[model samples]
Target: MDDLRRIDLNLLLTLHALLAEQHVTRAARRLHKSQPAISHALAQLREIFKDPLLTRRGAAMALTPRAQDLQRPLEAALNQLTSLLREGAFDPHQAIRHFRVAMSDYAAHLVLPTLVKRLRDQAPGIDIAVCQASREAMLAQLGDGEIDMALGVFPDTPSNIWVETLFQEHFISVADKRSLPLRGKLSLAQWLARPHVLVATRPDADNEIDSALAAQGLHRHIALVLPHWSASTKVLTDTDLILTVASRTLDPVLHGQELMQFTPPFKLPRFPFQQAWHIRRDSDPAHHWFRSTVMDCSRTSPQSGEKQAVSR
Candidate 1:
């Protein structure tokens, strides 16, 4: 208890950096402190814990058994303390933060360009890393802190996640204007008969579009299964293959291409595009700022007039 009284909060931060980096030089670099200061802290830490927390192995430093035992609990405690300290307010302009966002290629195409531009203007010091992943992978990434937020449709949300609907979009059939006799529309039979390009990030999981068709005892001829939304454009442009994509996703991809958008004859459920985050970050100021910024960007994005009719 007396040792606890002698401890400074900064020592825990140094210990965290040291344990994470496993080298005094690296820890000092991470803490933005002089190497001697880090060594001094390590010395103090050794005195407090009555153990050489780190021991040199050849040229590298390694955590001792006692230090290894403290790693996880120390990291978790530090994270909790950091979160508590950050609850007051967020200043976007001055804060330097790295935000990791998991999004589909389609969402990145439609949303990230504008979101990045807005973030650059509003929060110059903040950096964003966009990762492409399936919804399941994204949820796992969120839980593990690999991603800060996820942007896409999540039909069934778990209770532990927090979701905010950004916008609603619906599917539109896109085909080469010249290759197919598509005059802005296709019948149910025509739509089903055409060879389609399906975008499925995970091949094993059934896409919502396919599931909806299966419910109605109908299925389209999916001649090509691509992992990305952008890949469908080349197939649609070069062949008679039709691709059904979200209206917002289609709008951006169709630019400079001969693709023509038409409403599907069969009714499909509208996509509720949302931003999801772990419930742990629901009240974090930086995360709140990020979510708010994304929401603002999604709301102000220019709508495609052609797809306006399909949006509900």
Candidate 2:
């Protein structure tokens, strides 16, 4: 405590700039200080640390072992202090951050394009890294801080997770026009007669569609079980297999002449499409801004509403 009290905070900032740049002139330019000022701070830092923190190595300066040890902790401490000072103020236009998100291909297709476009226009410095994972893995990643957010149908989340409904999504069936001549709607008998393509992250387990069918004491033969919703619709082009998927995932199929869509013959209720994050991030300004931007992008879908939010 005595050693800490003896050190000046301003000198530590100067040391950070110097260590990051490794050159007096460069560090001065970075901190907007004169080269002499940085040199003076470097001298004081060396005295305080009782060592030459930076030593000349050929044409460039390199950090001494002691300086190298302090680099990461010093940077983290400064960042935490900065975050504390700006807790409630987040300027998207000036913020440079990278966010990791987890979602299925269906939800990515529904929201990413609009989300990216909006980011380009409003928050150019922000970048997004998306990963695809099963529901269980997504929730686990959220809890571990491996992912910043997740978008999908998440139910019965833990007390530390928060969910905001982006929209209500319903399923629709699609089949190759060449294979199934009928359009508009199919009777339950016709639907059961045709082979179906099931898109599920876990192929072994039953999905909502299968559960819905089983409730009525009926079942459809799943000829193909695949995880890619975006590519599953194309599989129907040359086969008799039918794919029942989220409505937005079939947007291209709706316009293409190769395939046709019809209402699901069973009573599969509309599920809430949602975005979830760890409660630890609930009050973070950057995270709050990003969640709001995602919610705005979700409005691009034709049928979006039922604004429900639950946090614990």
Best by TM-score: 2
List per-prediction Cα lDDT, in the order shown: 0.78, 0.82
Model 2 TM-score is: 0.68
- lDDT of predicted model 2: 0.82
RMSD of each: 9.8, 12.0
Q: Give per-residue CA lDDT, model 1, range 150-250, as digits (tens).
A: 98877766444667778778888888888666466778998888898888786666687889899999988888887887777767776888888887666
Candidates in order, TM-scores: namely 0.67, 0.68
Error of 2 at 16 (Å): 30
lDDT of 2 by residue, 1-312 (tens): 998898999998888777656778977886789999889999999999998999999997888989877876776687687688887688999999999999988888888999999999999999999999888888888866689999988866864567888988788888887777555567889889999998878778657899888888988999988889878877787777888888888867343788888888788998888899865455467887999899989986555444333433
Q: Compared to the true structure, candidate 1 yields what TM-score?
A: 0.67
Off by over 4 Å in 1: 1-88, 251-257, 301-312
